[model samples]
Target: MDLRQLQYLVAVAEEGSVRRAARRLYMAQPPLSQALLRLERDLGVELFTRTSRGVILTDAGRELVGRARDILHQVEDARSAVQATAPDDSATLRIGAVAGPLSAGELTRPILEAFRALHPDVTVRLRDTSFADQVDLVASGVIDVALVRCPVVHDDVDVIPIAAEPRALFVRSTHELASEQTLSVDDVIEYPMLGLDAPEWFSSFWQLDPERGHSLVDTQLPPVSTVQGIQLALAAAPLVVTGCATMARFAPSPLIRAIELPDASPSIIGVAYRRGDTRPVVRSFLEAAASAAAENIALLPNATSSV
Candidate 1:
């Protein structure tokens, strides 16, 4: 019925639990519950169905939550637009990037340069984050935009597909698979796999072990948190790491060998930002990213070979 009520509804929908939503909003549970009940009464529809785990949105709830987010984002954008008139308002654009192969200079630098060329007055800040944290960071307003790998699942964020890079398997040169020119997902899974500390959906796409239903937590090798950690694990053990071919080509170690996986799906690179973010600078950056991606893709090798 009102912005406050809409906020409550959206929060509950996102958190999927009244208690958690109330905690996030720094409000009492009783008032939040009362508010939702009043909203359901006014709308004459049950917004959520309570379950043992948490709550699930009904059809009406889903529709309302989608519009509510758009409205809230518009309100924030209106406030920001008015505030932009003040002389002291800073012109800094904060960007979050997942620390991995695609975050390398070869892919990111051109986009940065293109954005800078267009918006000379704006100062750009880059924050290095994990794949799991990128969507949350954008939704919470910690960053204006993010460059990440798919599949990102969040209703409050919008992802734009940029490019798809071929997948490859990284193994120690001493490993048996290292000498092989190409491999299949079945072949790579036999060795101890090096897993990254990333979100399940994000990591699953790169692992290509869905047929066996393998999980990174079940990996024999210890999980790594960064690209450097992955590199170290590869050099120290015969563990296999799977990722984009572009990343393997960038590896510094001669001891590491990257073998293509012809049967595996390519890793997708995408740009994401908060849904309904209508800022001019944000729009400009996205355009620049698109242009940069097109240019970069042209330079990429057509087929993945030994690296």
Candidate 2:
């Protein structure tokens, strides 16, 4: 009935014990138990099956858990929306993006600059994170807005396509394949492949097989940083990397070249946030990203850029 009851119920369901849940919720066991009882009474259903092994969700409990999580998420969103309206004194916007900026052929400065202009007091903290996990992070109030690659399959979060840039395969200029107009999966398999630090939608397209002659020369390198991946590929044989035109423009190495694979489609880069969050600052940042994305796409390396 009350938010506390729902909160207590969720804690118990997660912790699987009234006593443990109480510890996690920082409350006494008896009161937590009473809250659950009251909730079950109001709902007119048994939510959990109690045992020494800990609580097991009854069919009803399982059903309620999903709704409870949604409810909690909505509550958190509402609270955040309120706080975000009046810019905080901290003036910090915590944003996370898929780590490969140079390889992805995208630039984030336009958005960062626009946001800084409006909220000069607001410092943006950008972290290299996974596109896969970012949706949940935004929905759970972990990050304000996540720069993610499409297509997202979640109903709880909303994604706005900010840019669509071609995916490129980077190789050293001296490599045999580097001179070719385009390359294929088989053509580059024999060489050591440098992969991104995090998985994007395009990762599945490569489909490298270890048993089928494509051996991983190194796995110990940090797979998340684009800079690191490029560095590793430069040192190794036949490094297969992906990026866009924007990346090639800013690349530090003259030896590195971006080549387009006719089969490799352009990846969709987007801004993602909680579906229901209506904060003005968040909205302003989204607009800025959209605007910057439109201009930056033109700068990204196209499939036709001289490799």
Candidate 3:
């Protein structure tokens, strides 16, 4: 019925308990429960069924929760749009990037330099985020644009393909595969791969699924949420972390070795923004990014016969 009610519904659905949701929302349990009851009464449907453990969403609740999330996202976007146009802050451009490969100097720095060259008056702000969060940030207008790795299959955002670079397997220099000049997707999959705690679409792209029959090996290591997590995991074991060649070029870890995955398809990088965004700054940055990608295409990793 209202944004606050929708927020309460979403919080309850995510937290799975009225008491827990109340704690998360910084509100008392009674008021939160009362709000949920009022919402259900207005809608004439039972949103959740209470249990001793926690609340479970009824079939209608499951459907409504999805719609509620979308509505909340739009509401947030509207608020951000208005704030961006406030008299004092109209000249700022917000950019979001997934940690590691795309955020490195090789890709991000050049794009920033080009955009700034064209728009000297705008102040650019960068937000480093997980791969899973990049798309959401763009869609919710939290950032004007995002530099994201591909297989970004969301209808709410439009993606412009920038560059396609070869994929590599990163492992500790002391690992057996580290000495090899080239490896196959199959070879890399034999090791316990370090998985990322990212959206399925985002994570699947980095896994070389297209080249490897969409199969990834199991891992005992807990899933990592950021690039640093992947690096830390590699330092601790003989695990495999798949990424673009640019990552190998910029890595600070002397113990890490990036071996060419000749058989795997190259990873693609793209610029993503909300579908209907026509802001001049966003368009200018995207154009600059595309130009930078074109100029650096020759620098991308080349495929070779597996050794």
How many angstroms is residue 189 displaced in model 3 relative to the true structure, after the best TM-score fit? 3.5
lDDT of 1 by residue, 1-307 (tens): 9887898899899999997885454344555778899999999999999898888999999999999989988877775676467454238899888773355325677778889999899999899877568778988888989987666655467777776667788878898888999888877666656776765546555554353455443366667766677778888887777877767766557878889887776666678887767678888888888887787765556532111
lDDT of 3 by residue, 97-184 (tens): 8773455337677778888999899999888878668788887879988888765645457778777668788888888888999888
Question: Could you estimate the TM-score for every candidate?
Answer: 0.67, 0.54, 0.66
Candidate 2, run of 10 with poorest lDDT: 204-213
> Quick one: best TM-score, which candidate?
1
lDDT of 1 at 152: 68
Encode model 2's per-residue lDDT on 1-307: one tens digit a residue. 8665777778888888887875444334554677788888988999999998889999999888889899978877786677667555346677877654532344577667777888897778776765346666787777888877544534456677766666566777777677777776556556656655433323333324321223353465445345545645655655566555455566557777777654544556778787766766788888888776676655554422111
After superposition, the stretches of candidate 1 with alpha carbons farther than 4 Å from their true spots are: 1-90, 216-220, 303-307
Query: Ten consecutive residues with minimal summed lDDT in candidate 1?
Result: 298-307
- Superposed on all Cα atoms, model 3 deviates from the true structure by an RMSD in Å of 11.4
User: Per lDDT, what order, best first?
Assistant: 3, 1, 2
Please give the CA lDDT of all the candidate structures. 0.74, 0.63, 0.74
Candidate rank order under TM-score: 1, 3, 2
In order of listing, the candidates' clash counts read 0, 8, 0
